[model samples]
Target: MTKVFIIKFSIFILFSFILSTVSAFAQVDVEKMAKNFNIYLAFPEKHFQLKDGKYSGGTSPQDFANVSIEKIVIKDLNGDGLDDAVLVTVGNYGGSGGFYELTALLSTSSGLVQTNSIVLGDRINIKKIQVHSPEAHSPPELGLIKQNFEILIYMLKHKPNDPACCPTEPTMECFTIHKNKLIPCKEAPEPPVVKKPALYLYPIKNQEVEVEINPKGKVLKTIPEYREKWKVYVTKNGKINGKYNYLFYETTLNAPIPEYQRGWVVSHKELSRWFDVTLTKFGLNKREIRDFKAYWLNELPQFPYYEIRPLDTQFVEENLTIKINPKPATVIRVILHFKGTDTPSKLEEPAIITNVRKGFTAVEWGGILENSPNSDIKPQAKYSFLAQDTGVVVLRAIDLREHKLSIKLSSNGCTDKKALKSIVKKLEGINSQVPHYEITLIREKPDRCKALISEGTTIVYDLKEEFGINTKLPYTVTVKNPIYPLITDEPYFQFFPKKELKPKPVEEDMSLKEHLIKATVRAIEMEIKRYETSQQRDKEDKIDRLRNEIEKFNKMKPEDYILGYPNGAESSMEMFTYGPLMPPIHRQVEAIIEEPLKIGSILKLTTMTKSGPFYHIAGINENIDIAKELKQGRYRMKLYLVYKREYFGFIQNYYVYIAEVEKQ
Candidate 1:
């Protein structure tokens, strides 16, 4: 009986060992299963397809190039005593960007079969995937595993605040298999709100201190500051309630001094010593402190203060000049203002002042009236100065403030009526001239006008016509030429010849020329065969046309030929037609007169002649002479006409000389 029992036990142990080994082998191959799941998804067939059918069944398997399995998790989900598969795949379709999907496949006796699929979202990212662990619950409960361990997929979802390429929100999705179907389970709770730490600066007596505080307003720590004038800076970590992980220190000059001291000046050497001591107290090594001190010395400003003062209150020609006490490393800006307006208005664009030495700087204001008429100076105008790190100061004009003129003007001796009359008569002689008057005041000293004329000066003056001259001028002039009709030949039609029209030679075929000949022979044979097979009477006519076309092509040359048709209707007929011909190209004409004419001088055409098809100053140069003697005249001293094709048969340019006159 003992021997029989031992034999039975031995057989039982052997059977158990074999069964265990087979079970181990039966376990699912994760990589192989993932590939099969990807194919089952049929991504390639959906992405690339023709209207008639999908492009999926070729000899080679479809790669689904842009689609990839990002992650896979295997676990039992339905109490089936078999591991199930969950795959996260990402597909990128060119312009549409990327999309992510979650796929669950159940293990059956045959193979892994897809039970459920869920499209996550466009441009989503799969962060992680795993079996839902019951241990995650507080005071771990048994009911969490009721669904045979639910599948948990962790992904990054794109929120409104997220960028186009990166997702920002963390999301957890739970799924379970019930009744042979994948169903959604309860979602995990959202993460807790994080608290960030910040650094705040507060004034302590005569010094400043930096204190780090948590989001709840609780003090974390105080960053040590060696010098009373030093400032501390901190940067927060990535999380919303994250701690500040970085800190830096900088020396400042805006710190207030002790109340006991009225005024104190600190030298550069003393400041350097203080900086080194402060850095050392902050736990900086010798090398670091030395380097920081060197940097501070190099970056220190040379001058700390600037001063501006009005040089002259009374300005001539609306000019204003100011004196600035120069200081190195300081910038100054000067702006002018017009007074007696609804509000303080700028006289002109602001001027930048830079690169000054220790001496006084002088700034002049002139040409303000011509450049900025909108801000032209009124009876009462003022100027303002602004220095960097300093405030602005406004100063009244000296001349306007005092109600006096710096320069004297006398128009009593300046009169020329005879010259004005001559200019008017000359303008009246020209049909295109428009007569106008312009009076200019000539100053004995160009630099010193009737009023102050400086960099930003604006002068407003009324001209007395009795003491001025009337200048005759034409704003625009048109040159005309007579029209003439001429006949010419124009192209109508042309024929292009073809030397060789043949397909490229294939490696297995003959050369291009020989291939063409063979193709031609084949075409002729086909035509002949068609002609013989057809019962219609027109078949012979078609074959004859094809033969003629071949003959003509064979005899054609390589060059293109052009045929001319002079008449509109008949190609073979040539007829005379009338139309305006292009005008002859002429060189630009210019001349100078030795004497300057008055503002009202008139210019008249003295002669008219014919050249080519037009009559009237044709070949002669047409231009009004501009000379110093004619500077008093506001009108054109010399006129220049540039000939163009559009003026071919309209009008010709005429030249007029101004009569010499004596200056009064």
Candidate 2:
């Protein structure tokens, strides 16, 4: 009996040992699960960059590895505030190639650390999976109920037509829990409460605030108005606009009290209150600190109150001179004068003297030091002294107090190399640099003018007329290296340095062309006027003069003047003319010529004796030609009369008429 009991105990122990060994090797045999799933850490400080295997490149997946990524969200696997990553791996269970495992990585100080592999029990096949709500944080508990965050893992089953794989069949195998631990009862239904996304605000001082949502979160009322120290209302989509009021003050030259105090309005939607500001004051008030005087003030966004920085004031040396020689630039007026100095500290009104050289004038001074208007510096009385010739001005500040500052002043003439150098030196000292406008070129002409020549491109007339740029069409602007880089448009042109050529006097050539044309036109005009005057005199005189001129012109030979040919070639030339005839003669000729000329049956031409011949000429044809006999006073030349060719001695009659040949 003892021997049998001992054997039974040994058998039991052997069976337990076998079970333990199998369990330990079972998980190890399956393909090792992927580890180290992580989301980004604190904002821009600790951010994400794409890793080589599955992500990070250009616009496509195929790009250089190790691209810097901005941000990505991750969800917590359990109820912990920290987030977890989802990953996939395939390998042998115990050997090199057996099973595949899907796992997650959680955030750790050392780096991304692997979390426990979630089991997709009994399925044996998951084509794809996703984890949602990756980055969740714990909230301060305000009640007995602690805030619970959860992550959703979606698994795509590979079995086709299976209820779990077929969406139409609507079947799923889910392994989930209420919080971190497994569900108490697997039969319980998922909660139905809609979890709305909370709004997060990021404000930039003096700029707009931005808002965003993630993880398919919905915001029904993104613009919730909060009225406590300040009020907020929805100004734009998903953003809250707010406005607040605070006291603003400006001190006067008098030490007694500040000049003014009023509520200044401001708007803020930020978590922080401090903001930088600039003030521009315009009013119809006192002269010294009013009307046109503007002070730029910087202050905190929280208050209406502002502290006036030390005034940016510089005095020009009194007697400035600009020579009107060379190319006389349009001088509208001049301003250069001296003024007494005043301390910014104590309160007495700043002195204003006459003829302050203003407008777009530059001033030169050694250095300028101004105490903050709000600071404890005593105000000193200022006096002005003007010396226009030398361009030297002086401003001596005097007070009953012990401190005195005397500054030398010179005109701020950019043309004056020395003064410009000083201005440039002073400019370098300022923090926020502004390029001074020594000159601004503008085009205003036939069109709304354009720059025909700029930095380099050869501008065309049509381009100048239309786009005002040297490009044929409008360009799409793309920002490259923004600051100080040249902006170019398509089709981009390369600029080559061109040798500068001094302009020669084009006025002489232009003047010669203009005057020569003018003279010829004027002479032709004068001849027309003279002819009209002669015709306007007594009818007989006009007729006689016309007749005489016609006779002389027709009787004249085809000289060089008439032919206008230097060699006087007259091989095929024909000449003719006519003039007014006396009444009886004209009446007889009209009776002879009228019916035939009008009917176009025969041609009659009256010509001066000098017209050599009308060879190959014949009477007009009534059917194809048309003419009208002129009354005596309007007699003119015709070239259609018969003529004998002196050299050939050939008589050729042609159907020619004065109307057809000479535009009668």
Per-prediction TM-score:
0.24, 0.15
The Cα RMSD of model 1 versus the native structure comes to 38.3
Give candidate 1's error at residue 13 in angstroms: 5.3
Which segments of candidate 1 are over 4 A away from where they belong?
Answer: 1-16, 37-65, 133-148, 186-664
lDDT of each candidate versus the true structure: 0.33, 0.25
**Best prediction by TM-score:** 1
Worst 10 residues of 1 by lDDT: 572-581
Candidate 1 lDDT by residue in tens digits, 1-664: 9999999999999999998876655554643554554333322223222222112232211122256667766666555677666777666522224556677777888887776456666577788877754333421322332212466677888665565467888887776554565655532111111111111211112232232211111122332422322233322211111232222221111111111211123343455675565434333345444644454344332323111111122322122111111211221222211112212222322222233422221112111111111212111222112111111111112121121112122112222121111111111223445533322222222221222211122223212233222223232221111112221321211111112122232233223223233333333443344354444457677667657645643553322211111221221111111111111112222222233322211122222111111111211111233353434422322221111111212223211112223232
Per-residue alpha-carbon lDDT of candidate 2 for residues 1-664, written as tens digits (9 for 90 to 100): 9999999999999999997777554333221211212222211111123233123333311111232211122445554544444444332111011122334454455645644333332223444343322133312221111122333333444333343212232223322223223221222222211111122122222233222112121112322432212133323221335432111111112111212222222232321121121111211113212211222112122222322221212211111121211111222211111111222223332232222322221111111112222222212312112111222122222111111111222121211222211100111112333311111111111111222222312111122332233233322221111122222221111121133233232223333233222322322232233244332335455445545544543443322111111221111112111221100010111111333232112223332011112222123323333334333232333332212111111112222223222223
In model 1, what lDDT does residue 329 have?
Answer: 29
lDDT of 2: 0.25
